[model samples]
Target chain A: METVVQQLLNAAQLGAVYALIALGYSMVYGVIRLINFAHGDIFMVGGFAGLLLALRFTWMPLWALMPLAMLLTALLGVAIERVAYRRLRQAQRMSLVITALGVGIFLENLVRLGVGPETRQIPSRMPTTPVAWLQDALGVSVTWDKLLIIFVSLALMALLWAVVHRTLLGTAMRAVADDKDVVPLMGVNLNRVIAVTFAIGSALAAAGGVFFGQAYSLDPYMGIDLGWKAFIAAVIGGIGSIEGAVLGSFLLAGVEVLTVAYLSSNLKNGIAFGLLILLLLIWPSGLLGRPASKKV
Target chain B: MSLLRLEQVSVAYGAIRALHGVDLEVREGEIVSLLGANGAGKSTILRAVSRMLPLQGGDILLGGRSVRATPAHELVALGVAHVPEGRGIFPSLTVQENLALATWTRRERRHVEEATRRVFRLFPRLAERRTQAGGTLSGGEQQMLAVGRALMTGCRLLLLDEPSMGLSPLLVREVFRAFQEINAEGTTLLLVEQNAHMALKIAHRGCVLENGRIVLEGPAAELAGHPRVREAYLGEAGASSPPCPGTPGSSR
Candidate 1:
């Protein structure tokens, strides 16, 4: 039972990181129907952004540093949209997909050149002593970092829910997803809405990047594996639904945790992707996504 | 001066020309219906006016100023509200949210409550279903909500494409009655319809299009009774009308 509880905590931490990164995929897909392959690089860039901030302003708290990374990363996301994706708005879907992959490659190589392809340790910002209380009381291991990850992710998801369901911009985003062509008829500038979507999505991914860096060492290529896993989570949950992305992320993490605990650790990613295929075979639209209806 | 004018406007989807030098005019304070069968470029004309499609030739003037370079979103702020062929309401949004979205371009931001009240008053059915998802509403209710959405934009010109496409005759009449009330309040209407009979009852003037060219333009009553309009659009009932005394190929 103690081992199971320990695994659950680990799963929760992993799920929170996946959820944050998956949101970027879900949101961009919801608005434009593009997979935004470059999104994973944005996550890497975010870690680098945080690294730069931490190196220069070593006195800044994690709270301030994370937001600053998100802000810079959000701007980078918007710039990617403008430079790499905007002109291809009307081009073939394949071309957009190719361009996105190209952008990801370009970002990876640019960071490799800038940072010299060496792994860097993020200066530990979160305190470790707070975990002692939980460790003693519960008689099970619980790190402050894991607890913080869960709490921050829940708070961000709640805020996202409010933005999507309770605000005017949220309404426009939903409307644009439903019908991009007709949204303009209602006097919405599609470019502005798309930009805002990219910004919010990228910012969330940046937050996830900072968290991942604190939990794990930062490398230029780290985003490739983590980003793909988060994307798989988004797809498993339902590509366009926010709730689906969260549910999918948690499920993927749970499966991965259970596999590493009871089975071969090498089988963790294989099982995560295998479960995605199995779930998709059973319910093609993911868990929470409604089947798209045809318009007359 | 006319509120909207299309001067020898031409549009094509690749090699297939939808509108070839199609000249149309809608003066202020008038309800004009563009009547045609499917593929007659009726909807294409509305698309061109809304700037949804680029004009291959000629120009579209809104109050004597050219709008050729204006984007589709700008047209609404310029006072043109286009309710597209499929009644493009955001299905996931509540009925009230759908109406609220229309006010995005309205200059009088403080009067949003009044604008929403006007929409509710015009379509009391919408008031009852204010919290319902737009997609779940019955077709007639969705149509009502679509028109109500347009009204929320404070548009001086309403461009409706196939407003009666999927409604029962009773619901169709109810919508046209609402259109009449809307026009009486000083909004001009340009509607394209396949239900020529119903559209004619409310339209003040009408134009007939065949193969991307205007075949006839006259008062609604005259166009309704024209021989070719009957042959092309009205079918069996049209054959009963007596030929005019002197005009051969009269409709053209």
Candidate 2:
């Protein structure tokens, strides 16, 4: 019973990370209609930024590290957009896709050049002492690390919801997604909105990176596999929907974790993609997207 | 004084010119009709005035100042509201949200309050569907919503392209009557229409465009009585058409 509870808790933690990274992928895709292939590298950059913050700013509390890291990561995102995505805004989708792939490669190489290619650890700043909680109403022991991860994940998602639904920028972002050509008609510069999208998406990816570094040791190539996984999560959720991405991430994360635990031990990533393919066969627009409308 | 003027304005798409060197004017508080057949460049004139289309060789003056290079959204601040071809209403937004977007730059919350009241007064059907998505509105209702959305911009120069298009005869008359009311309230209007007879009836002055050039220009009553205009637009036989030059537009 304890093992089952522990397994469920593990799945939830991994799911939380997937959800964060997936949101970034989905958001950037929603506005630009591009997959932002560099998004996983964005995660790596964020994780590194968080590590720098932790190492450099020892005075700041552990909780403050997230907001600070988000700020830095958002700035990095805007810079990346200005350099990489800006020129290709009106280019063909394939061109943008290749550009994004270039960005990801550049980011991985840059990280390798900046820091050695060895596995790195984020020095734990917070208490890691396990606090136990009841699971499944069966009084099974569930650890604090899992609960903490879940709590932070929910809080971040809630914050994201508020930013998306309540703010002027959010409205502008949704407007961009709906019709980019009409944005200037609404007195909004499309470039600025696109920049903001990159900023927000990258910032979120960074937060995911930070949490990931804390939970597991970081590597220069950490973003590559995680990034692909998150992209799959975004696809399964519906690439343009916030709720769909989150829900899809949780489902995908659960499938992967449980497959490793109970099913074929080495077929973890394989099972996730298999689920994605099944979803595509059934509903190609993903679980939440509106069906495509034909122009008369 | 004229609030808007087109001084030999010309527009081209690729190598194809849609508007030839055409001179036109709109007074500060009058209804001016641009009467044409489809492809006569009537919509192009409105597009030029709104700065949606670039002028190939001439100047569009708004209140005596050249507006050839002014951006589209800036014209809204200058009191030019363009109800573009196909309405261009945001389909995802609700009626109220569309109206709010029109007034996004407005101050005097009271003015917005008053505008909302006035819009509801003008379009009660719109009020009935204020919360509904714009895509679901019927053709006539969408026109009303389009007009209502334009009104929220506090524009003085209202450029309407084919307001009477796709509406029923009854709704058409109702839409024209609403324009009459709007004109009475002191907004300048540039009305573009393919239905020349209806257009001439409401216009203080009318310009007849053929193949991208203004072939005739005068008071609406005079142009309405012109033999060629009467022959082509009223679907009656002209002097060139028959034994009588005086036979056309005598009914108007």
Candidate 3:
């Protein structure tokens, strides 16, 4: 029973990180229908940005460090849009997809050259003594680190939901998603809305990067695999729907955790793609994606 | 001064020329109708004014300021609201949200509120179904919502492209009546339509376009009675004797 409970906690922590990365994928797809294959590289960029900030300001609070990294990463996302995606707005979808892969490669190699390819551990800012205290009090191994991660992730999701549903910028985002040409007729600038979407998505990815760095060591190639897994999470949840991304992340996380705990440790990483293929075969639109409608 | 003036404006869709030096003018507080058949380039002229399609030659002046370099969205702030063909209503948005989006470029909240109230008064059916999704509205209601959204921008000029398309005759009449009411409240209108009869009925001046050039232009009554316009546009074989050769509108 304790083993099952511990695995559940682990799944929740892992799922939160995946959800943050998946949101970046889902949001960019939602507004522009771009797969943003380079999003995982943005996550790596955020992790590196956070690591540099941590090194420069060793006395800075985690709260300050996280947001500063997120801000810089968001700016990087906007720069990517301006320099790379802007000219290709009217290009074919296939061309955009190919360009995205090129961007992913560009970001990965750029970081490898600048920072070297060595894996680096982020100094732990969170106290681990709480895990012992909680385990002693509850007679079950409940860690404060996992709980804090889950709490922060849920809070960010709630904030994002409010901004998307209640704000004017959110409405503009949805309007552009529905019809890009007609949105300009309403006096909403298409490029600005798209840039804002990229910024927000990248910021979320940065937050995920910071959290992931705290839990696991960072390497230039780390985002390549984790980013793909989060993308699978976004797809399983329905690529364009925000709620579906979070739900899919948790679901994939649960599957992997359970597989490692009971089924086989060897099957841990393979479970995400395996489940995605099975779910897609049964429900092609993902779990919560709106069914494709005919264009009028 | 004219509210909008198109001087020697030309447009091409790749290899095919859509408009050939189309010269037109809309004076402030006047309804000027551009009447034509399907390929007459009536929609193309409106697209040029809205800055949707780039002009290959000539210039469009809105309130004496040239709009040739302006982007499409900036035209709305410059007091030109275009209701493009097929009612460019954002279907997934609610009727109220659609109206709200029109006020996006407006700087003052008080002005936006005032404009929104005016639109609701102009079309009360929109108010009754304000919360409903725009897609779910009936054909007539969607047309009203489209025009209402244009009004929300507090525009000095309204450019409509085939507003009567696909609407029932009764709804068509209703929409035309709303156009008159909106114009009476001090907004200038430039209407593009294949329905020459209805368009002429409401317009003060009318121009006929055939094969991308203006073939006739005069007061609405004069164009309505012009022999070539009558035959080609109104689809009528006239029994009345033709007007005298030197009559006011005949020579041009």
Candidate 1: regions farther than 4 A off = A293-296, B107-109, B236-252
Ranking by lDDT: 1, 3, 2
Residue-level lDDT tens digits of model 2 in B49-166: 8887778988988898987888877778788888876776677667887677677557478988999998999889999999897778998998998888888878898989999889
Decoy 2 TM-score against native: 0.89
DockQ of all predictions against the true structure, Cα-based: 0.78, 0.30, 0.64
- A1-296, model 3: which lDDT tens digit per residue? 67777888889988999999999999999888899999999999898888888888999878899899999999999999899888997899998888888988999899899888999866766665557765776557775766787888889888888887787788888777777788888888888999999999999999888888888878888889989989999999999889999999999999998998899989887776889999999888899986677656
lDDT for each candidate structure: 0.88, 0.82, 0.87
How would you encode candidate 1's per-residue C-alpha lDDT over A1-296 as one tens digit per residue? 77888999889888998999899999999999999998888998898888888888999999999999999999999999998899998999999999999999999999999987999867878875557876777778777877887899889988998998898789899998888888999998999999999999999888888888887778888889988999999988999999999999999999999999999899998999999999999888899887866766
Error (Å) of candidate 3 at residue B186 is 1.0
Ranking by DockQ: 1, 3, 2
Task: List the candidates ranked by TM-score, beginning with the highest.
Answer: 1, 3, 2
Clashing residue pairs for model 2: none
For all candidates, the clash counts are: 0, 0, 0
Tens digits of per-residue lDDT for model 3, B108-192: 8898789878888888899999899898998789889999999988899999999999899998998999899999999999999
The CAPRI class of candidate 2 is: acceptable
Report the Cα lDDT for candidate 3. 0.87
DockQ, model 3, C-alpha based: 0.64
